[model samples]
Target: MKKSVALMVGLRYTGAKKSNHFISFIALVSMIGIALGTIVLITVMSVMNGFQSELQERILGMVPHVVVGERGEGVHDWPEVEKQIVQHKDVIAAAPFIDTQAMFKARGNTRYGLVQGVLPEKEKKVSIISDYFIAGSLDNLKPKEFGIILGIGVARSLGVSMGDKVTLLIADGGTVSPAGFAPRQKRFTVVGIFEVRSEADSMITMIHMQDAAAFTRKGQLVSALRVTTNNVLDAQWTAYELRNQLDDKFYVSDWNYTHGTLFKAIKMEKTMMGVLLTLIVAVAAFNIITTLVMVVNDKQSDIAILRTLGASPATIMKIFIVQGSLNGFIGTILGVIGGVALAINLPQVVAFVEQLFGVNVIPGDVYFIGFLPSELHWDDVILITSVALSLTVLATLYPAWKASRTNPAEALRYE
Candidate 1:
């Protein structure tokens, strides 16, 4: 028999329903193992991709695309820096800002917070802070006027709302008095409340640019120039460009530069997890080797007859290799289909599981995102499939070699 003919016969022999029950059972297990491993690996990769996507959108949306400040102390001319940064191609908007850690008070209540001083009109161009206006407008941020915007959480904590008065206690750099360090306390009417669903809701407060300047002791100069970009990924290069265009005292930082270390760690973790799971599929493939070798052993007499009829060693080898490989190929195809289906419906699947189990699988406080996320990337599936197919092919080598080396005379003599 030619090698092609032998391979077809071998495949038929292995898959024959009336074949030995033991061989069939082992084949079943091998298929199941491959299917399960592929499903798990694909599902995990999808979830990781989903998480990375969500985190990037939210982080970039809420945070500044780039921040330009003084490298040593503070920038004396924030307006000049802002002007230069806006010249970058991706930069959509730039605004002068001063951030201060301070205490807020209303109705004898107190809470620690980050107070942001922003240019009412310009800040809107860069950040969505204006879009979140559940209350008054930024135009109400009149210079030297006592007005403030609070996050919804901060407003609720301080027991105040729009049109209500609150006191901002500048923690430092206020005019000193006989009593103590005189607080630059201003009883400002709450004009707006915004909700970002992040720590920002509790930590962020907004005030007029002039008021923020006086409190921070940065007269006529803002602490940082907040920038928004057309493409968030271009932030780093934009920062670099801003620095290059400006003087030595100025420093620019992009979103990646600020959060690079944390992202690097996540990348490491994802790689390790994929490697650990791939071993499961590899171990499963090895079982195919055992199954093929056993099949070769049980059919020794049949092989001898085939050899007498002019079957070549290569033909015998091709037969067993095809049979073992079919087990891998079938499982892999099924796994890919099932894995992709699960990834596509993961959100609803998670919701169903939660309801069925009557449990909270993902607690909102623990995870930055509330829902189970999934993003199917075809590239990842292709890569995983290639690795699996390679491993499956490798499992056939030893068994195929053994079958090819079978001695026709020795086997037929015993029969």
Candidate 2:
């Protein structure tokens, strides 16, 4: 009976007529504040999640998940080693590759990049590089043809195109002539151009393995064995396992060893962004406190009347708690609905915004990804809603307590 009465009176106070327009406006502001804060927090966090995920796909997709190589003489028996590595269920595919750092000059422009010698058919098993081909076929890199595939950015920088000859000069390459031992140089026909929309696109070029072996003077010996696994997230552990399976003469490397720092930095930035944006919700929660305080002041007479009519202080407190909590609850529901709807379609929203503003939000050359991404995680939604609701409930306590302490005689005297 008491609970029902408290609820009835509390709701009546919340829905007070337009005569108390100031109180109504304040309540409306509090709700709007909470709603807006939740929406922004959810939307921003989703975008950050999207960035981290997309970076993983773009960066990791082109790089080896794990590499196996001989510590001393390189992987001379890479074919046998690849067979042994694949016996482990975690490894899905393995490919032989030779990697070297070199400078390429073509059409009067020069660029320094990594030159990788790969078998076209086997390379497809371990990498998604083939999927990114803009021109020419991987099969065109026939053995002894000395044909090369260049990144789009690298080709553009060097002003070269399909069928154009590029000169590759390596640090270790050169025929020793008595007076001048010059850099070993080889001419390669540009057979393909690939674009991954990343830094890799500017600094990676590929050629046939036999051509690389001849250029490096390591015939039949590959620099490394690249392997892809069933689970990329578990690549480091799988690499360690592969190392254990191999003799001490061989060493194992993974993508984490190569690009872990970059991914870690991205994750740290996302966390920091989440913490900073959460403060917006905190500020909105403060407005809830203000709203409840004003409501307490306006309802003092009502509260006193209820107290005189046999209502306990606890009931008064519960009344105001329910009232304030309801406001927050309503805002939270609306915010979640709005936030989820917006986050799921964030890419389209970004596109629309870019069009409206006449700007390119994510240019392919400037950013690793050419589109804005949003990945709404259920965990983030739950956490944000919980925090918002908790803040709103906590904000009500002090004002509710003050309302509960109203002296009926003094309140009635003023009335």
Candidate 3:
């Protein structure tokens, strides 16, 4: 009988009755549902995280971590102050900047633009501004000289190219220039062009720092200091430290503070998506519960036979537990394989699909990068795996307990 029991429960397949094939099929559905749901959830989350990582590294790379400036007073002692600020342990680099609103006129076209003044040599280290120089180099900027770099969009709109001079109309400090308090006008040579793939790309122009000071007739003072830090997340604290170390007249601001609304929106969106997708996995887990419960109901006679043969309740629980967990194990293994494969190969897959369809699904300017970016973080994958496994364990509890409580004589008599 022991040999028979081993053969029935261990070696050979032991099921409740001949009429319970539908129960087995239902279990298969439960397993497949789990696999599909887990696959979709992990794949979608990974892609979202990858997209966020690309935005931080690329778009934020173009902008500095922090900017120190005041509303009206601007910045004073900018060069000496920048030198002192860089002495901090967290400070990486600092560059003086002249940011002002101006109107650019070229070939009967007028566009409002943001005019920024930068030092030719120092600007490259802090920002990826040099990388965007598709047409000309920052070496073209001359000290105390008027040369300008046009963005790709700005140049296209104005119908101008390198070496074409354009007029920059700036508001001089409410001074009367023989014509009762009018705006000041200056001409700049368009020596370079850059493309940042943002709104600024359409309306930004860069000139030499000294030339900008001279053109605006402002003294050696600048409008701001673009400061780079070793860690961007610490920028807000560093900004506060800068404010306290310096005078109250000066203000310090970080990227998070400057683009607070946008970053907040991204965080909120990612969180909402996570919650929504997790619901699908939960529904799949419910299917697992139903499958296990039905298996318990169908196997009552086999369970009674086992109990009559001195099988312990814990052993009885283990039997159904094994059955339910077998389902979970297979689903999790397949889901992980499928999810990781999709995450790793998403970019190539997208390219292939686009080529096959003969369409440019990802536009360079709109999305910041030329293609869909993906970076599969191992830590995120581990967390997802751990959570999924825990949910699977929870999915087996009630059904296993129900199987353990069957009455041997009553179940056999009914059978």
Top candidate when judged by TM-score against the true structure? 2
User: Can you tell me which runs of candidate 1 are displaced by over 4 Å?
Assistant: 1-4, 71-76, 104-112, 128-170, 174-202, 205-211, 214-219, 354-364
Instruction: State the local distance difference test value for candidate 2.
Output: 0.88
lDDT of 3 by residue, 1-415 (tens): 4434433452223233436777667767766776777777777777677667766765677677988876575677777778768977888899988878898999999888889889977788788768878888899999866889998878988899999989988886546766577777788899999876654567678999898888777777788889888887788888888878876777788998656566677678878877776667667766768877887787789889989889877777776666666677777778878888988898899999999999877665465555676667777667666766677778878887898899998899966
Models 1 onward score TM values of: 0.84, 0.91, 0.83
Give the local distance difference test score of model 3: 0.77
**Model 3 residue pairs with clashes:** none
Determine which window of 10 residues in candidate 3 has minimal summed lDDT. 6-15
- lDDT to native, each model: 0.81, 0.88, 0.77
Query: Which stretches in model 3 have alpha-carbon errors above 4 Å?
Result: 1-25, 70-73, 104-111, 153-190, 196-200, 354-371
- Cα TM-score of candidate 2: 0.91
lDDT-sorted candidate list, best first: 2, 1, 3
In terms of lDDT, which candidate is stronger, 1 or 3? 1
TM-score of 3: 0.83
**Model 2, residue pairs in steric clash:** 173-184, 174-184
Q: By descending TM-score, how would the candidates be arranged? A: 2, 1, 3
Backbone clash count for every predicted candidate, in the order shown: 0, 2, 0
Clashing pairs in 1: none
